[model samples]
Target: MSRYVLERVQLSAQNHPKRHAAVSCAIGGLLVAATSALSVIQRSETVSWPAVIAVAVIGGGAWAAAMAVFVVRLQRRMKPLPPETDPARVRAARRLMRNGELGPDPETNALAVRMAEQLQSIPRWKKFTTTAFLCTTILGVLVTAPAISDGEVGKSVFYGACTLFPLLMLTVGRARLDRHHRNAAEIRRAAEHRTNTEAER
Candidate 1:
């Protein structure tokens, strides 16, 4: 069980991806708080301030953790980079050699060109860093919502983010991820074509 809990948090393509980052960060934050609470099961010092602190610690820590994860990942994901390498290089190279011409790509430049092309199509960081920011912000509100005297703040925060943030990220990421994936598929095709072309040459 303990192993399972940790396993869920380990970094993966799913966890690292921008679209999932917000939820992962939010859950991670909450998980931290939950872990702190487990200390009580072992101790006989139940029914005291310690219990309160433990719960508070867990919840608060989770909230903080969620915030950090989203911000960092968002920043990194958004950075600009060169294009991906297309497999077409070797074949293209052979073709160029046979024709006694050099243009567009040298062996070294092929990979760079691929990466440059990819970078041109991806989204920026500010566009996707909603991970901790949205998730923790939501968790923070939900954590505080019950304390609202007349449910005023609860309603305000809940509708504001639960609906707003997710909707915004979903709408944007839906398109962005789609494009990113499409570009990746294109790159893969380019690679295959490159390889096949090289073989033919």
Candidate 2:
């Protein structure tokens, strides 16, 4: 059941690189717009509207081009699983990979069990990065609030929405990563217990 779900997701992503790339470019455009707005806000006393628009357009275009190329290359490297492959093992392997515990032969159960031991505790670097993203999210909202309250409701909404998009992504991505980590830890403990019971027998 879990294996089927995992494989379906993997196959969908692998088969739809263009869709993913389009989504990435959209997100990139939001980030670029937010950044351009921030620059304008910082120079409010001497802001040039034309320059800001030009910068945002150029930045967004460049980001879209780069992401399209990168996504295409990445997708090209992902090989599809054979019809005869075990989906359960593939699911386990991907779980390990997500937690950075996947070994050379990810499809092997024994290798996955041994590698899972490394995920017993969350790494400090992961915590630090999550904290950094949270801080940035908070800062982005705070910085955009005054502008949002000003007379320019239209412009404010545009800037706020653009800024909020990435912040939301950060928050959501963190939550998903934490969930994956928890699932990985549970799998590790189960594997360890099974190993010990087998050894005792």
Give the TM-scores of the predictions, in the order they appear.
0.34, 0.46
The best candidate by lDDT is 2
In Å, residue 34's CA in model 1 sits off its true spot by: 16
Model 1, range 1-201, lDDT digits (tens) per residue?
A: 333333233233223455445665666766656544543432334557777577757676767666766555553654322223233453443333333333455453344334434444445555445564577557645644554545666444543454455656656855765565555455545656776898999
- Candidate 2: give its CA RMSD in angstroms: 7.9
Error of 1 at 110 (Å): 7.2
What is the per-residue lDDT of model 2 for residues 79-165, given as tens digits with 9 covering 90 to 100? 544445565665667666466443445246554553344333324366677676677667667767777777667556765675676
Q: How good is model 2 by TM-score? A: 0.46
Runs of candidate 1 with Cα error greater than 4 angstroms are 1-56, 60-159
